[model samples]
Target: MRIGLFPSANYSAKKDIGPMKQMGDSHVISDVLALGKGVAGSQQVLCLDGASILLRKLSLDSISKVEYENNHFCFGVHFLLEGNYSFVSTESKSRLNITSGSYNLVQWPKTNGVEKLKGREYTSIEVFFTQEFLEDLLGTEYNSAFEKFDNTLVDKPKYLWNEMKPIPGRLRLLLLDILHCSYTGIARTNFIESQIRCLLIEVFLGKENGMEQIGGEATLSTLDKEAIDEVVSYIKQNLKRKLTIKELSEVAGFNTTKLKSCFKKVHQTTIFKFITQLRMEKARLLVLEENYTVAQASYEVGYSNPQHFTVAFKKTMGYLPSLLLTNLS
Candidate 1:
């Protein structure tokens, strides 16, 4: 199941490579592709009709490197859930450091790069789409919304590369859901395809809403920046407590108005929104990763009523907490 571009010499000889021949679709075939020997952990590869999604939670005990040379023209979005890696591009002589809490979108071209994975555990999701599939999905006006790479297309770049953007709150939740999904057979296929469609929409259309351009005239002083960072740390540490802007302002040593404006300027989101995002993220992690009951998680995150918590969780995460529990069970 090796893709022609990413060749590996470390495949287990005992594993049956011929199983890939029985895979009926391209998505399934791509999912089973050998990722080399350094990855050891749970993996789920879903081959949808239009796209292929690979979710891996693995440990890299040794340095793993992959080099590509002018391979297929496809669009890929890689989500780095945990761990860090560095990429050195031979073509541009550029180095990109991909860290946890960030995602990278690239229009892979005829280029060469070395990916150096540190010896640690990593969780990641990668979605790949062919040119025809993307063209069909994006339609004629794609050029206006997406910038090209390397002048590949006559009209514009067929794909766009967005390096190291913070994952939006909803998209993060969706990725968690995909990772925890328990369905199988046709239900699993349909669920994955739907998730991929939503993910693509979030990446293409929802970029502007989540990404803040941090340059130009608006800037924060070093003292103010440190204050905002402290406030963020405080909020995360005290999620169970009822947080108010006034209390946060006191911590930052600023008035309420200045506190709100400065916090938004530094974090690219308002204080309340940031707090809510953190609370929801923590609550979900507790329920899904730590096996906390719904009521316990809700109360731990400062919800007085379970019903109220359910409403807020559904609104913020686009699904009920019970769904996560059900998948976990």
Candidate 2:
């Protein structure tokens, strides 16, 4: 399917943005959309196994609203990284405010719209996942959340997850990492693939936990948030070893009580619970991908007793490790 970007209201006749092209071991496409006066924008697109990403940047001296043929598209996240714009759905008569440092989930059917920009420049990244891709990733776990998006075409377009939310600090960092990625060739693909998966998990898991990125999170100082982020990095690197909240507090230069509060504020989970989830995830990969036995996987993730690991695995994954092994084809 082709998607078009137009500089004016004549978008009803504008055609394709061109086909996605692949090179070597990765798929990426780069293009420039020239709208009206001084409104030339550069865009980069990357294709994964089941989803596509679009990173767009534009600068203008005098701005005019740009229209787009919002044909049938995949469900996705819209990350507005720079400037400000509001999308006015022509048919639905609904307006979506897009501002710098804000992100939201967009699931819409075929509807054309005008993008009204409020700043000198605009920069954004969109990650769209096919229905098949979402279903395969979600499995039965997110069945209820998955039902939020409607595939049916309607004369008036509607947004499934319409709340405009501020982008979390962690996700902001990840977006910059992708934008500033310096890797070459296949390593670039691997880097972006891993980053995308982590990003998707953060978004989806937040929904599963019934947690919103509350305004209280802004109460954390920049230095404190960075300190907490560093602690999380440390835990992941040392997951196989014994870890303690006291040690993590020292790492963050906060006392145990402050450490607990700040960590939960930033991550929405306790430190120890986060560690257990990480360990179980690692053990799952070891068993399913590396063919490790359940006992070995358990030991590798820092569990001394396989029985305890089995119980934890069922709680996290909703099934026994041995069962997953036996069922693998």
Best by TM-score: 1
In candidate 1, which residue ranges exceed 4 Å CA deviation? 1-7, 10-26, 29-40, 47-51, 58-70, 89-93, 110-114, 117-121, 147-149, 153-163, 207-259, 262-268, 304-308, 318-320
How many Å off is the CA of 199 in candidate 2? 1.1
**Residue-level lDDT tens digits of model 2 in 1-329:** 43323233365336343433454454766653444576766667677666877777677676557676555555667788677767787777887766665677766556678877765767777787767676777677566546545676555434555445556545655775576466667787778777876777667655522234332244777798779868976887798899998899999999999999987765556788778876876787677657888899899989999899999878865677787576355
**For candidate 2, what is the total of clashing residue pairs?**
0
| Alpha carbon RMSD to native, model 1 | 5.5
- Candidate 2 Cα outliers beyond 4 Å, as residue runs: 2-26, 147-154, 207-329
In order, what lDDT does every prediction score?
0.66, 0.68
Cα lDDT tens digits, model 1, 80-169, are 766776666666766666666567765555455666666477777878766566667768745644543443632211224343555555
Q: What is candidate 1's TM-score against the reference?
A: 0.68
Measured with C-alpha atoms, the lDDT of residue 321 in candidate 1 is 81
- Scored by lDDT, model 1 comes in at 0.66
Clash number for model 1?
A: 2
RMSD of each: 5.5, 12.6
Clashing pairs in 2: none
